[model samples]
Each structure stands twice: as C-alpha cells, then as structure tokens.
Target: MKYQFDKDFLWGVATASYQIEGAYDQDGRIPSIWDTFSKTPGNTYMGHNGDEACDHYNKFKEDIALLKKLGIKAYRFSISWPRIFKDGKYKLNEKGLKFYKDLVEELKKNDIKPIATLYHWDLPQILQDEGGWSNPEIIKYFVHYASVMFNALGDDVEQWITFNETSVFLYLGYLYGIHAPGIKNLDLTLKAIHNVHLAHGETVKLFKNSNYKNQIGITLNLSPNYPYSVEEKDIIAAKTNDAFWNRMFLDPILKGSYPEEILNNPFGNTLKEIIKDDDMEIISHPIDFLGINYYSRSVIKHDENETFKYKSIPQDGEKTSMGWEVYPDGLRVLLNYIKENYGNIPLYITENGAAYEDKLENGKIHDIDRINYLKRHFISAKKAIDEGVNLKGYYVWSFMDNYEWAEGYVKRFGLTYIDYETKQRILKDSAKWYSQVIKNNFIEE
Candidate 1:
C-alpha cells in the first residue's frame, strides 16, 4: 500500500537549539538552565552536558547542506533565549541573531521553509534565579524577547511556535525535578503553569498585532488517555487524567477556560489562587495552527490511593528506547479527538519519531526499528487526513542524534547518526528512506 501526501503538506525534521548547538558560551551566549542543571552533580546521565553538542553552532552550514541533501521541504529549529539576551537581561546579542539569520538564509538558499520554535526548555539561568516561569515578571521578559525575534526575523520565518512541549518542561522541571532547574514543588509548578500560559497568550497577541504576515502557535506533547477497562471507575479515572493532562493546557489556549473538574477540588484550589482577571482571554487568543508532539497513549486505571485517583497501567507492546510503548493508532485517535473537541483548526505533527538502539556497522546504520516506527506513524497520520482532519504537516522529532536531555547521548532518536567523539554525521538507513519519502511526498509499505 502506498499513501500519498499533498504537495503542500510540509515534510521536515525538528531540532532544538540546546540539543544540537554546542558553543554554549561562544559569541556572547549566556548560560541557560540546562547548562547549570547539567553541570550540577547527579543531574544528568553521566553528568553529561551539551557544551559541545554536535558543534552545530560551528557547523550549521554543513548541517543545512545535509538538510538539502535529504530533500526536506521545511526545517523546524529553535532559537536559544540565552543566546539572544546577554546575561539573560534585555540586552541584544547581534552575533547570536546573525547565526540564526545565516542559518535561515542557508535554508532559503536550499529552497527549504524555516519554522522557528521560540522556546524548547532552555530557559535562561538568570531568569530561573528570579523564579523562572513561576514569576509573572517573566511574562514581560518573554514577550520582549519574542518581539525582538519578530522584528529581527519577521516574515523571513513564516511559522513560529510560541513554546514547545509546555507540559513536559513545566512538569518535569518543577514537579518531577528531572529535566532542568530541578525543583520539586507543586506550588511552584502551579504558578509556572498559569504564568507560562499567560506568556504564550501575550506572545500570540504581539505576533498578531505585528505588521508581519505569518503564522504563530504552540506545540504540546499530547498523549490521548484511554481507560484501562470498561469499568465506570476506570472510565472516570481516564476522564480525570484527560482534564489535567490535556484540557489544562488545551482549554486555556483553545477554549479560553480551564476544565471545571480541575477547578472543583484538589489541585484546582491552588490553580485558582494564581489565575487573575482576563488571564484566560489572553491565553486563549486565536492563532493559525496547533503543533502536536505525539509519542504514546496512556491507559488510566482507577487508583484510590494515587493522586488524581488514577494511575497509568502499562500496556503490552513493543517499546522504544525511551521505554514508551509503540502505539501508532494513538496518533489517528488523537488527531480526530482534537478536531472534534478543539475545532478543526490547521494542525501539524511537530515532532513524531522513536528512539531506538541504533548500531553502526561498516560505516552504516541499519536502524530498522526506527524506520518501522516512523512508517506506522506516517500511515496513522494519513488515516487522520483521510478522515477529514486538518492535518497539514509532519516534522520528525529530530534531524540528528544529539544531547537527549537527562538521558544524555544514550538514546538515539535521529535519522542521522552523529559520532560524539569525532562529531562525524553518518546518514542512517532511515535517513535514506526518509529522503526518498520527502522526494516522493509519500510512503510505501
């Protein structure tokens, strides 16, 4: 079977600044939260840091050349906030701006569209010291920084993502203390949640009010929650999980209100204390599209002892290197759910790919597991499109293997394999297969 995508359907790859761009301190780039957290003892795998990650800051031209070779129609990459703001202050960094400008120019030279993500979990450390996302003052700082990018890049970059994976960054950073600026406080997490949404709303307002003609939106790591069984308790537990996991973020931006279930009891009381007048209006401002980073689904079972009265039940299936189960049909179900619940707004699969145990043999990588993962997901996306969902584009999670946050370089999620020691990039079998898919704008199984 061969599934074909429209010519206008963007086929691209996604990457983040901190994950790929090494030169952490070069060219007036200040330290971000990741830098501080990764440097602290017992924070990351082997205490690994991204100080020399792929050296992309020094070899962007080479990387852009690689993108051109892959026949990608678009490239989604992030801009480092610390790189643009000196000492995490309101000062401009021309060198930092120039690097991205050069990168955009190179992508245009290769006829590839540029999609920029404003934030990808690399908050400036100075801001963290001042309470980070938990501080309302950070909203103005974020808007100012975004305004600078709007004035600098403008229409040269068409699609702009206000933030990437807010749930992962906020929950992991504040609630779980696993990612960066490691802090485990539910109070701080609740504050950070409201403030982050306010920040996103303000940025969208600024973009829409600008003279530039372009698109702006947010990317969320959404996992569709399914009940473990048909039991009424399990069903209610799944609904509760949906309220916090999906609706808490989606409702503010798409529906202009928080879930009533969440606002009723337990965590709702804390969230209510921080929300102010017109905050939801700002957070729910209209935008062009929604970017979804779908990886897996959750099976919620009733748990009287667990917080939220629910716990995830592990499903029996093939798992990725990240220990996430491979459930491709979840993508189709998620897309349909978004369309039915949030209105059929334009959508993009901003990040979808799996991490696997990639082995290099004879100067080539035969990552068949990763390839099958992508193929199944792609078909699922096509199914959604056929079912009248407004799915427009698909950007694979990564362009190359780089620093994978707390997991460090152990989990490989890229089509291109990067040699950490030599900084050499080798095209894996999946990359070759993806290149053909991009060229043909279709996939065959």
Candidate 2:
C-alpha cells in the first residue's frame, strides 16, 4: 500500500551545535561541559573530541546548501550557550549570537523553517562549575539563557524546543559518568531529575508570556518498555521502568504530576528534599506540542539487584551499529500510546534514524541498510496516521554524520556520509531516498 502524509506535515533534518559546529574555542566561545569531558583522559572513544567536527561552524553555508538540495522544508539546530555567554552567564556575546542569527536568516532565505533547540547537552562550563542542573538555581540560569535566545532569535524561528532529551543528559551524566560534568551518584541523580522538571516548567512559563510564539515544545528520546516475559515479575518490572523513564518525564509536563512511585520509592527520602509543593503547578504549564525522539524499544526483566529493579533483555534481531534493536512496529504502538495517554496533544517524530558502520565507495555511499530501516519506520508512521494519531511531522536523526558522543566520531547516523579528513559530504543512498520522501510528502519504496 502506498501512503502520503498530510500536505502540511513538517519534513526536516536535525543537528546539534556541539556535534557539528567545530571551532570550539573560537568567536569568544568558552568550553562547554562536553568540550571539557571530551578532552578528559578516558571519556570518549579514541580520545576523539568534537574540536573540528564536521567543521559545520565554518561550513554551515555548504551544509545549508545540502539541506536545500535535499528539498527538506525545515531545519532543526541548537545554539551553543558558551558562544552567546562567553564572559559569564549574563554576558551577551554578539558574535556568538550573530552566528545563529545568520544561520536563521540563511535558512529562511532558502525557504526552510527554523526549529531551534535551546539546550542540547552543551551546558556552559561556568554553570557546571556552579553545580549544573543539580542546583535549583540552575533553573533560573536556564530561564535566563532562554530569555536571551527568545529576545534575539525567537522571531526568526517557527518552532522552539526547550531541551533535547532531558532524560539522556540527566540519567547518563548523573548515574553513568559517561557524559559531561561526570558524576555517578544515585542521590544526586534523583535530585537532578527534579530540578530538571522545575527548569522545564520555568522555561515554558517564560515562553507563554513571550510575544514571539509560533510553536513551542520539548523533545524526549522515548523507548517503549515491553516485558521480557509474560511472568508477573517481568510485567511489573517493565511497567516500573516505563514509569521511571517515560512517566517520570511526561506525567509532570502533561499531567502536571509525577508518578507516586518515583516519589515514594526507595529513593523517596532523597527526592523529598529537592521536590517542592508548588513545583507541579509550575511544571505543568500547557504547551503547543510534543517532540518524540524514537530510536528503539526495550524489553524489561525484573532484577532485584538493579537500581530500578529492572534490566533490558537482549533480543535476536537487526540492530543499529549502536547495538539498539530496530523495531519499526514499536513506532506505531508508541504513537498511539502517547495520544491515548496524553489526550490529543500535537506530536512530531522529531528524531528517528539509525547509525550504521558506513564507508565511502567510488564517490557515493551505497547505504541500502539505512534506506530499508527508514522504509519500515515510515510505513509504521503511516499506520499511526491512518489510525488517527495526530503525528504532525517527521525529522530524521541527523542530516549528516558528525560527532556521536561517548562513542565519539566512530558511529555514523547521517543520511549524508561525511569525509572527516577532508570535511566533504557525500549523499548516501538513504539521503537520496529521503529526498524523494520530502519532495513528494510520501515514502517511496
């Protein structure tokens, strides 16, 4: 069966500032937590940092040209905080702001809608030194930075995402010690999660009052949790894991509340200290839409020793180079679940694509695997739309391969293959496939 998305569906590609924009220490931009972490002794793969990644900071014009050629109608990108606040938290570096302004203008000139992400895990080093997102005061700082962006670039942007994957940054940073400002502590992680909710609420309130408003929302990387077995223990564990990862983030924003289990769990005492009474009302501020970043789903099994009493069960199937299982049907199931749970709120597949071990061949990349992966997912998206899910748009994981973080530059997720040494781009077979999808508003098989 062939299907076409609604003509108004948003078709675009996304990239983060730290992942692509090199020139890390130039134009008065100081070190972000990522910059410091990548340079540390044993954080990322091969000691590879994003110092000269994709060189997108300098090559943005060429990149914009790529987007234009792809025929995508939208481009989603993040702004680096250190670039704008070079001196301190409040300092406004015009050069840093101008870079993004110029990017926005160029995007508009090319007929692309600009969707701006306020924070994509690039916290200014100064803020991390001052306790980062763990401190309640950090909420104020985030709101201030958001205000600055709103006043400067908000008018040019049609959509604004306050934070990209709050769960990944907080969970990975606080419990895993893999990401920046590394701190692997359970209590601190709990506290940080609450503060993050507060920061989200505060920022949404600011956007509501701001005059420049087209569409505003948050992007979450969600994995549907299914039980490893039909056993009671596994089912309970799966639900608990869902509550922690999905409900923990969504309930606060959509329902204006948190799961009672999270508040009353073994970590109850720790959560109480940081959680405030008036926080839910603030966090629950209504928004225009929700952005979902889906990659893979997980099968949960009960494990008493694990912190959450749950663990992921490995399965036999096609997996990404990142080792995540590729399950396209999960996309439709998840889309329907969100709508059933959150009431008809507008939704966008903000990020959905896979990373593969790709290499150049003769002037182009024959990435048929990526094309197949996206075809299945796009089919699943059409199913959701047919079932009446209000899926507004779809944006691929990335436009081009750049820094992969933690794994560093080793993994490739871009539809466009990048020649790292020469900073050249080759449109992979997946890119050509995606171009047709955008050009026709339908996935052509």
Q: TM-score for candidate 2, please give it.
A: 0.98
Per-residue lDDT of model 2, residues 265-295, tens digit only: 9776787776678988998888889999999
Rate residue 44 of model 1 by lDDT: 93
Candidate 1 stretches with Cα past 4 Å from truth are none
Q: Find the candidate with the highest lDDT and give its number.
A: 1
In angstroms, how far off is 420's CA in candidate 2?
1.0
For residues 230-321, could you state the per-residue lDDT of candidate 1 as single tens digits?
99999999999888788889999999998998899677789998888989999999989999999999999999999678999988879998
Clashing pairs in 2: none
Model 2 scores what on Cα lDDT? 0.89
Candidate 1 accuracy as TM-score: 0.99
